[model samples]
Target: MPLPEDAPELSPALDPWEGLEPSGGQGSGGGRPSKPGPGLHLVATPIGNARDITLRALDVLAAADLIVCEDTRVTSRLMQIHGLHRPLMPYHDHNAAKVRPEILARLAQGAVIALVSDAGTPLVSDPGYRLVVDAVAAGIKVTTLPGASSVLAALTLAALPTDRFLFAGFLPPKSAARRETLGELAPVRATLVFLESAQRLADMLADAAAVLGPRPAAVARELTKLFEEVRRETLDSLAAHYAAAGPPKGEVVVVIGPPTEAAGASEAEIDAALQAELAHAGPSAAAAKVAAAFNLPRRQVYARAMALKAAAP
Candidate 1:
């Protein structure tokens, strides 16, 4: 029977020990076997398109004694698409603590386990970190089969400076808390990346604009899928657009450009801003906020804040 149209093409079989001298091992008297060696393998699944998975990732998935994933149903579908049928175990946030010990025990017994998330790389805002940490602490080998990541995908589409960038997974949902978080991130002189819910996109963009000013930005959604879209605009413009449009469909990633040199703020202007922040925050916090807002040095702002504090009645 012919393979399905969506099925991955298979390469012709080759001898596993074709190019090796005998080291007293497995195939042909000492060569690597077709199977993955025993240990934990952090596998990266396709972010959206199932075909985005790497060849080596498929190899590990095929050879793994067991596959540990965020959602068995989702991973099962991916396996089905790729014509794989490994035993899968659920290892998500809710059950990780309960199941980790069992996984570790199996690893201790030399099981080749492949760890994968529902989408993208394992442990990127997923529950795999603790497992990796435990695996390492237990002296078990841990390695990664890196592949598709939404973070990188969004950044690539954002058209912003990528040399210095930060991936801040997600922001708080509430407006006040989210704004505070944005305020804290204001001083970072790099492109900022964040994953957010579609429902919160407008509000998040608004808060970002309010805190980060009119920096260039892009909001990428449905990445790598048929409907993938990237909207590049200034922070305020994106915020306005989203507010008017009332959020969008699918997963959202916001990439904001780094701070640009603003016209230097006068002493009076800095002092006034400092006073406003100090009313609700400590001098240090106030100084940081003002410094970030004005693109001034934290030490300079802090010193001025202290002076203002000393001079106050």
Candidate 2:
């Protein structure tokens, strides 16, 4: 069985799941396991370390009537390592429309189907959301067996503000569109997280530096594995580092810090800003918008707005 070009450069047998007790699947002799409930079970597999899987996830995978995945071979290899010889079928973006109805039919028939991505949790960046939506509409129960998430893993490693964060998914592949999108999110006051391909990482970092300015940022690569690395630096330095080093291997996530007090504009600048927002908004509302943007006092922004309005044509 040949691995796909996109298949992870990992052997499932390595770094065996530490907390999981080896249990029954096909020949797994932990003992006869209790049957998982019928309907759809969304299972989360490890992102890097193979042993990050949970005991309950193992039980569901073992008892599942069928295991649906984005890539059959990828999931098969993982199951083989864990000694869970469950049946597997493909359910990816390309073929999801055609395959989803069949999956729903299986659930309707009381099949305990487990849906998993090639790695990590399903439905985050994957195409599992549509299936989940349809399954719920068809009155099929959908239960998620929560475990191993790259988003959470990267956020924790990044050492940024955990109080608030945004997972922005992926940027557009084209440079122009990516920059424009980044510009739209420039005013956001929380840490920004993005999932980027290893090959495009350097370019993405460069664009973030150009559009988002020099906020502190972190690049987490090959997380939870032997070579796991978390590089925390300002956006400009990260851009420069990756540009010089070329793209590193494996999965990548970028976490960027929010704007600092310097984001506040001067009085003249605030007046110019209010000119645009004031025409469409009343003074109080307009000042509130500017105040939030710069974390300034609303009274000051309101006074500025009033002065700007009285002097206007």
Candidate 3:
């Protein structure tokens, strides 16, 4: 989420609103563009810090015909703090089906609408995707204004690999479902991020260890708040801690590091590497190279090598 250094300057607080506007028009956006376009603006609000709101986001909110949010009270508080009052309408999961048509009608009439989640970015663990899909299908312009996100926040301090990471979101609550989901992600080969209820933290971590083996993991809670905490340990140890100490308070994000090559490489990759070595070398020599390359056990590699050779012409 970075830009070229040569890009025209805007407020540094404008994390995701680059070039959308000249940083002015209404609210804190001190100047005015000669013209303003009407479309759906997907705005990102703060995860915790109220000061994290961007100047451009405030301007969009001020200029929009109406603001769609999960809760009017939440948006009203933000509006009060910024001294920018705009019309608010509820568009959460329960009423989205009934209210989406009304929102479309307004968009068709050239209304500039701003969509926001209660916290963080919109459509993250929310029901906003369908609206975006429908808007695009209806030829309505839709864009996003990114800002603070808990997912990124947890990732930064979790001390895990970010080169390749997967945001797996939340698993099912039941033990069997959670274990099944964990088994499915057992070989993701990247950091696995999940949002879990505070009450379910212990059971979830326990399931992760049993299904995911001894990979390094971190549990982050109460992020950006007074009592923020991030605990890093192996899957088994983290599970034992949470199980013994009970669930920690507030929102939680679990980040699990990817497995090492011995455990991470797929069966197909192991076999391919083995076959290439087996083509010219005898079974013992071929198995040694393949085992070293993938950091796998010699016995396993040698067994696979024998199987491949026996089936060969």
Candidate 4:
């Protein structure tokens, strides 16, 4: 299909997903439905596989008067594949501050606007958070068409505990800053998910290994597409493997397992360490130092140290 005037340019080779026609039920293809009020729709697009998008997302995209996305070309190509078109407006980090007011203005005029990222869900390691925040504050209706997400995909691919998981988004670029962030999350009981570039994958994994210990981990890349691969191994092994092999191409999702039970120090072990520190320094200093080292509360360590002191002869 040729690109629409409002759609972005796409590769000459149309994706296989493009072959699938947009469903009739949703506002896809046919025409916009008559919704009484205008609202902002947060649409989740496919991460790698074009067919991964939801029917509702296509309907909203087809129905919405304006569709705001990170990259017009990227979204335009996808829309072209599905044979859907709409006014594509740029709403990315670079120009978010400037374009946000315009989007709000359209919403005020009862023009339904759908926000999408280049891939995956918007505001998920992507832009659109500010727009959602502002829209909600203005009492503008907001709806989410949940669909493909790299974080959820990585979590499923990693086969880690999902009852509780934290999406830390992308780590800092600087080694020191990245390490600092990892250190803060080291003791979190929930599995951790981070979006990273293939180039920085090795370094990020190494820092995670150092700060979070040798936990079980997985690296998922090219999610939901041909040649999609997910590798599960120990943190040290992954760090070493990626470091030697260099970063792989395509998008990457790094999922690290939570601290193992064995790694969680026993009370006796902690008390011993606390006793040694308390003997060398005052209780407060000892508590502060050990707490920082273990990512624990100083108050908790201070209480433990006091208990140890009382137990002493």
How do all models score by TM-score?
0.74, 0.75, 0.76, 0.74
What is the descending TM-score order? 3, 2, 1, 4
Taken over the whole model, the C-alpha lDDT of each candidate is 0.86, 0.85, 0.84, 0.82
Query: What does candidate 3 score on TM?
Result: 0.76
Candidate 4, residue 81: how far the Cα is off, in Å: 0.3
Candidate 3: worst-modelled 10 consecutive residues by lDDT: 27-36
Model 4, TM vs. native = 0.74
RMSD from true fold, candidate 2: 15.2
Q: How many Å off is the CA of 151 in candidate 3?
A: 1.0
Please report the candidate that would top lDDT against the real structure.
1
Instruction: State the number of backbone clashes in model 4.
Output: 2
Off by over 4 Å in 3: 1-22, 25-36, 263-313
Best by TM-score: 3
- 2 against 3, candidate with superior lDDT: 2
Model 4 per-residue lDDT at 153:
90
Clashes of each: 1, 2, 0, 2
Q: Write the per-residue lDDT of candidate 3 for residues 1-313, one digit (tens) a residue.
A: 4456798877778768555545654454556743246889999988777888987787788878999999999988988888989899999989999999999889989999999998889998988898999999999999888897889999877766666789988999999999999999988777799999988998899899889877667899888888889987778899899889987888899988776567567655777888999889998899899889888666556756775676579
Report the lDDT tens digits of candidate 2 across residue range 26-53.
3777677789889999999999888999
Q: 303, model 1: CA deviation in Å?
A: 35
lDDT string for model 1 (59-170, tens) is 7898899999999999999999999999999998899899999999999999999999999999999999999999999999999999999999998777666667899999
